[model samples]
Target: MTTVMCMKLACMTECTRQGIACMLTRTVPYATVPSFQKQDLNRTMDLGLAEDHFSRPVGSFVASDIEQLKLAIEECKKLILELPEHSERQKDTVVKLIHLRLKLQELKDPEEDEPNLRILLEHRFSKEKSKSVKQTCDKCSTIIWGLIQTWYTCTGCYYRCHSKCMNLITKPCVRSKVSHQSEYELSICPEIGLDRQDYRCAECRTPISLRGVPSEARQCDYTGQYYCSTCHWNDTAIVPARVIHNWEFEPRKVCRSSMRYLALMLSRPVLRLKEINPLLFNFVEELVEIRKLRQDILLMKPYFITCKEAMEARLLLQLQDRQHFVENDDMYSLQDLIDISSGRLSCSLTEIHTTFAKHIKLDCERCQAKGFVCELCKEGDILFPFDSHTSVCHDCSAVFHRDCYYDNSTTCPRCARMTERKQDDISDVKEA
Candidate 1:
């Protein structure tokens, strides 16, 4: 009767211990309860404890020690609850360890419905498997190294996507190629321009151009269709679109046409190359060479001769000077003469020479002044001995003493202009 009573007490103790463990699993939401339960059951089974032995009287079972078993289970619960939560890397390590422990527990039990634990184990293993897979950039197809943080996997191939490029995704096209082998070989091709094959722009049934060649192709997480970068980026609603060139062309044809047009304009028969002013001739010759090279032709296009280009071709063949007379009053300066010669200035060279001659005189009109002046002042008083009177302002003339101008305020007395007095002018004025 004592053995039966003791056995009943031990069975109650074991049940309480298992209940506490189950309660702990429920209280800690993040804890892996299913794994811990399996582990406890396996350890109990390993100790050679039968399912019925748990119900046997404590005194009857010499192998059973209830106190020791209770102590071990309490310690395990304390350790699980006190597990440290640290950095993400440390957390991952702990999770992996937990998964390994759970897997070992699963191996011991063949008939446990531990789906949650299995899922956690699978997630942990998948990360390890992905580390071995090579990843490349989707846009450039460049290989990546180290822990890939921003990569997506599609159809067993891994591709690294930039934050902006994450939106673009498409499925790869499969193609079959025949080689020397008995059967055709299957090959993978990037799916680009697939949509254009069937669908056409509503207004113009013209096929849209794709922007870039496909490097990495996968199904779009959002749209679920294969698309090239060009079509994907374009606004589909807009039809009959115009395209702009982004590339600059070398030896541009537009420039060549412009140069030819400008050359035709400046080639005039009346404007003789040899007769042109040396400076103007050099400028036109340099311009012609530049036209031959097609440099600066863009700026010269607007100034090209339109009507004169066609007329001058025939006129230039018969090289002749078209000369005309000019009235005296019609001319101005040397610049005016050149302008007239080039048909730019409306006046004649003869008019220009006549207008200039009126202002210029061969002999001195004032005092008929020539040769030496008075010896004392170093100026000539009179041109001839017969001429006794001064014909010029005496203050500035050779007849006057240099000091005389100073005595009279050092100014030309007749013209009221400032003058430098001579030494004789000072002496003569002092004597006066």
Candidate 2:
């Protein structure tokens, strides 16, 4: 009777413990599995199951599916914690976790179902001011007559879309200054064929057929990527790659992204033409003249920076639109090249150069005092390093008449005197 009582007491205690364990499992949201049982869960985080959840054609996820996804995400996080950091397996698990979380968020958030959109970058949209030019929505392929339908244009990229379609644009605006400021893709229409892109639109991943059975694929000249009609819309823009590699100014058909990127890069002054294609300057007469003018601008910048009177008068503001011209001689923006071709930039620079020259040479005595005298000619007339008729010494930076420099066998008088003085000092040091 004593032995029976002891066994019954132990049995009752075990049952109570088991009931409490069940309660804990039900209460804990993220009940972690024991290390020994993790092997059993290797098949629980099925990638195919996650892909199926995302690949659903049209309907929202059911409550049960969402709950399952949350559980799977928790499982994935636990698995990730067990793996070594930055390992390939851990990385893959992390990606799966992200997908699961995105799926869960999409299911829970009703905003994802709404037509309102978001983009990869910010776009500053303003009222479409031009009434005469017929514009179209970059998002939807529809003409936007300014007088009839209200629209907005992105001041950054010149992206025009209907007022309703503004929120619908998912493509980012061109922020060339923030991205690709120094480096530009120079290959001319470096198109990876449709086979390489798997015959899909680069932006939207929409199916594109070669023969236009369902959707036609269009090529963007700038990016060399294929796009569907909705993303292309037959928009034309001068490709920077073509301009750099082939010097082709003829506008070519590009996708919406390329169009916006080029428009924003128009006046950015990021391209170093001399570094990219020095041969262009030799062929294009305007480039040659522009280079000379830029050199003169560079020389004038120091005088403007130093003179209190020049600063007070805001002399540098004359080239406010082309501030980079004063900063460096080689960098030329795409718009600068276009304006040069049309004689607009040349005329504008000529006017600015005249104004600068008047101040540096004739107007400001302080600026005139900074001018270089021709050492070879020994003339009272001041010579500037930027003067076309002058030659600057390589060693001492002394200016002289080009003809006089050649006659003097390119010998600088100042450098010669300094060399003599150095030799005399060396002789005295040796004697001492």
Please report the candidate that would top lDDT against the real structure. 2
Q: After superposition, which runs of candidate 2 have C-alpha atoms over 4 Å from their true positions?
A: 1-137, 142-170, 176-182, 423-432
Provide the lowest-lDDT 10-residue window in model 2.
21-30
lDDT of 1: 0.29
Where does candidate 1 have its weakest 10-residue lDDT segment?
A: 238-247
lDDT of 1 by residue, 216-254 (tens): 122221122343332232222100001001111122111
Candidate 1, residue 69: CA error in Å? Answer: 24
lDDT of 2 by residue, 193-237 (tens): 988888889998889977885799888888788899999878899
My TM-score estimates for the predictions, one after another, are: 0.14, 0.64
**All predictions: root-mean-square deviation over Cα?**
33.9, 22.9
Give the poorly placed runs of model 1, Cα more than 4 Å off: 1-82, 87-95, 98-131, 135-173, 176-245, 248-432
